[model samples]
Target: MSTHVVVGVDGSVPATEAVEWAAADARRRGLDLRLVHVGPQWLHEGDAGHCARALEEAAGRARAVADGVKVTTEVLSGNVVEELIRESAAADALVLGSRGLGGFAGMMVGSVSLAVAGHAAGPVVVVRTAGAAGAAGASGHGTVVVGHDGSDDSRAAMEYAVEQARARHARLHVVSAWQLPVFSPYAVAYSGLVEDVVREEQAAARERVTPWRQANPDLVITDEQPCAHPVSALMDAAATADLVVVGSRGRGGFASAVLGSVGHGVLHHVTCPVAVVRPRQEDRA
Candidate 1:
């Protein structure tokens, strides 16, 4: 099957940057690109002819970046996140701007992007404002870092990271962090043992993906063992990565929720783009 990338755009600068980045990626990987613009239901009426026109212009911009890449335009009327999720259900991946033009003081990430990243069925890529233009000029050479903790969700993230690395011809950085019990009565006495246990956990994480790395010799694998919180370590590593891949949820608390603390923390802290991967409900059961 051909790869399909869905990009959410609303005529803002960040959305335009996301469209450009998604277009370049689709062109390089020989994938189809879908540009989606969602507005309030009231705008769908005669009040927002300009919104439809802007979507056409965005479509033209996407087409100019890549020739014959099956570029399609869509304008939906509903909640922004709901419309995006509905449209991107069958897509191979979803690319969205970190922030949009809605709400007061667009300093923080937009709610639409965060909602989709947390709950999308397939891989969701959140593109930030920085390196937006640079990403278009050059194919990404930096590595794709995926956070794995031996969970099914993390394995799904790894699968997406491997595919992205193959497409971009970049290295894959597999990272896992471990922390000792904070409230243990003998914490001081077992400090050394805790350190050793953390190291062993990191080693096991490395072993989990060894077979996949061996199969793809071209993939350079790097493992990290940070003596800090999982969210902080992953965010620090993501600063220099081309893309940060993470599971929707990890092994700790809130395992039943769609997004866990570590995933949510990275979404707000990381500067680079983040891809959250999750398996389908049927696969999980």
Candidate 2:
């Protein structure tokens, strides 16, 4: 089956904004758009009409603004989380607003969006509403920011990031971060060793991305500082980037951990859209 992007909407302002963002991304990637509105199965029989109207409105707006992109809408009956995750299995990327109208009020992050971002097999994008909660109003609008940590999943995220950059004809900024050993703070003897380790990590991360830069000659790969805390570094880059990408699981996680710390942090903090990528099956084991 041809790949397409799926976006969940609830007829809220943020949800409509998310559809618009997903529509543009789908158009740029030459992918079709699927707009999903999930409701509880038989919760309120009369609610079906409301759901249909909302989805139809979203689809209409998507078609009007996103030219050349195939747009389709579905009003699904089931638990919202399960249905969205089900759709995610076949989607290239799942997109949603950071908060949902039915989930919470005046909250920066909603429960459903967090659940999908944590468990989706592929990448999941969380976009905030316009203003300070949304993508930064910074000068650089077409820049893509991706985080790397030398993990297999991170490599997968980088591959996706490169594709996104190429699709948007945008510059790619790769950021890698490393921390000093925990013992360094308490043991003066280990300070020098920690310093050496930090330097080694910095060099290794920089070297790890060298081939990616070489491979994507068409993308302007900007070298970013790799020594800051992973979350802070990525959030800083997001301040001006159009999108920020990270691996679903990082090097520090157990095999069963669904979402790594860095990915969760970026999802919560970045003003710009954040995509969390999972490594392929073969790469994970």
TM-score of each: 0.87, 0.88
- Any runs in candidate 1 off by more than 4 Å, and if so which? 44-47, 102-110, 139-141, 183-188, 252-260
Flag clash pairs in model 2: none
Please give, for residues 1-285, the per-residue lDDT of candidate 2 as tens digits: 437999887878878878877887787778999998887677475677778888899899888767778988888878777888889888988988887764222324636776777777778888874732222222347788988766777888898899888987788998876655467356778877877887777677778888997888888998664565788878888887888888876663212223546666777778877888876555577
Worst 10-residue lDDT window, candidate 2: 131-140
Model 1's TM-score against the true structure: 0.87
Give each prediction's root-mean-square deviation over alpha carbons.
3.0, 3.4
Among residues 3 or more apart in sequence or in different chains, the pairs in candidate 1 whose N, CA or C atoms overlap within 3 Å are none
Q: Which stretches of candidate 2 lie over 4 Å from their true place?
A: 43-45, 102-110, 131-140, 184-191, 252-260, 282-285
- Quote the lDDT for 5 in model 2: 92
Cα lDDT of model 1 by residue, 86-195, tens digit: 76678888888777673111423536666777777778887775665235646554778888777888878888898878777778988777665564875687878877
